[model samples]
Target: MNQANFDEARKAEANYHNELYSDHEILEPGTWMSKPVPIVMELLERILQHKDHVTVLDLGCGAGRNTIPLAVRLKGTNSRVVGIDLLEEAIEKLRENSNKYDVADVIEARKGDAEQVDILEDAYDYIAACGCLEHVSSEEAFIKVLERMKMGTRLGGIHCITMNTDIQEVERETGRALETLIELNLPTEKAFSILEEVYDGWNVLDRKTTLLSIDEEKYEKPSQFRCQSITFAVQKI
Candidate 1:
């Protein structure tokens, strides 16, 4: 994908999210909105069940689909979540909803590009990158982001990264778009191998890939749309 394609895809994503944000359907299921992936919610519930006063970083946290519930879960506790997204509107909406849900104190909304893998400050108890990794520019960027994530996590910190392979995208084969969405097209097999190698010495909590059904009303290709999502829930060793 050229710069135009990348920009257009990003614009589409932002517009889609903005639409859902306007409709209050970004967090719901079986609606004309983007539903939170099951694995994401599952891991979050587990995280909450495991810790109370934890610090979290939510990457690609568009409009607080994941951040809101997390903040609500951590409200009144010493826990905190720093939510980041590329779209300023999404972050703004996140801020609004955080207050609406009375979790403004717990959620810190900011705008940042996930592909940059920017770690602001402090070691996080948990880091979540749902629907974020494939947006990276290249395999090298992927490795870099994961390495930074590992380095930024506490010794026992957990990370939940959920993303689609290139198969899920029409423009890029491997979803490693550097400069543009067409910068690289990595194979799924090799991608997994790299991940395995990268985590060779770390504790692997959970890693899997599956094709999940999409809501037709919300997805353009619902008839044949399936999210070939890869999920990694790991702990820093």
Candidate 2:
């Protein structure tokens, strides 16, 4: 999509969230996970090691699930954490939560897109992007964002990312007539193929396949739901 289209969609998303706050519980990150807290905490602890005076950035930091917690952890230290997302409401809610949860000063929330974020190169020690890549218009744009993140990080900086993977088995088992839905909305094995080919030098810390399931009610309709999961960390060269 063009910059104008990207920006307009982002603003609309922000407006939607701003007008609807309490109802924000419809769906969320890690909704598919049996134990999301532990998963997120594990990743945070691993990324925010004992580095003094480090800066961390969260791309697509929707509603501060990871942002607020990371800020709390980094508080009382020289470390700073910033969370950026396309939704104004997400950013606003994140800011309120930061204050309510007592990390407002440490965590700065902003409305931003990964493709257009402006930051100094090699300024951050750790960058995190959970459940975001698949939503981009294309894999090429996704990698471009990754490349920007890479440039925004210091040498040896860590990048934590989670993506939707191919889910043929789930589609078969669930009998979801969503193969086309999955293809159009979520990343596939081909997406990873592109990532592997493009970012050959990055280390793969952890890789896993997860089904996009929440509770016992597996979705089978033509919906906006993405249908797979993958998480891994890479160190910037």
TM-score of 1: 0.79
lDDT of 1 by residue, 6-71 (tens): 666666566666776776745566442345556556766666676778888988888877788778
Model 2, 129-159: lDDT tens digits are: 8866655666677778877887788877777
How close to the true structure is residue 76 of candidate 2, measured as C-alpha lDDT? 87
TM-score list, all predictions: 0.79, 0.75
RMSD of 2: 5.2
> Which candidate tops lDDT?
1
